[model samples]
Target: MNRPSIARPRRPRNHPDRFLECQRAVEDTVVSAIGEASAAGWQKDEIIAAMIAVADDMQLALNAKVLLSVETELGKLMKKYR
Candidate 1:
């Protein structure tokens, strides 16, 4: 018996051009940072660690923002329903 495949929800295709520009800027910054680090004689492990640290910090900030947004929406919903 063959299993049925599930259809995944597709992402919307209406993202703004600013997002693309921001993505390109981030890519360029990462590339430049890697090149500079290498030129400064940073070890492979050191570069990897620095990148991970930066990523972790960004993740924390994003998580906090998401949490705050969720809480604000929940408050609005509660007020509306009450």
Candidate 2:
């Protein structure tokens, strides 16, 4: 069976752009959501749900461009990556 591969963002490790920066950005958003939810007496699951929603949006936006240009889903998927 062919499994869908997840896109892994990689910034320059040696240069100023570090791959972990992307990870950090995602964490920061999640943290901000959690803090706001906590301040408003909202459940922690709300933050998790928001994060998942944001991830889907991000993926759609990121993939939309390549999705239009490529012929096959595999090709679009490959180009959407890096």
Residues 1-82, candidate 1: write the lDDT tens digits.
2223333334345656655655554665666677778878997678978998999999999999999999999999999999
Per-residue lDDT of 1-82 in model 2, one digit per residue for the tens?
2223334557665857565666665665557657777778877887678778998999998798777666487787888996
Candidate 1, lDDT over the whole model: 0.74
Clash pairs (backbone) in predicted model 2: none
TM-score of each: 0.53, 0.48
Quantify all predictions' global Cα lDDT against the true fold.
0.74, 0.69
Compared to the true structure, candidate 1 yields what TM-score? 0.53
> What lDDT, from 0 to 1, does candidate 2 have?
0.69
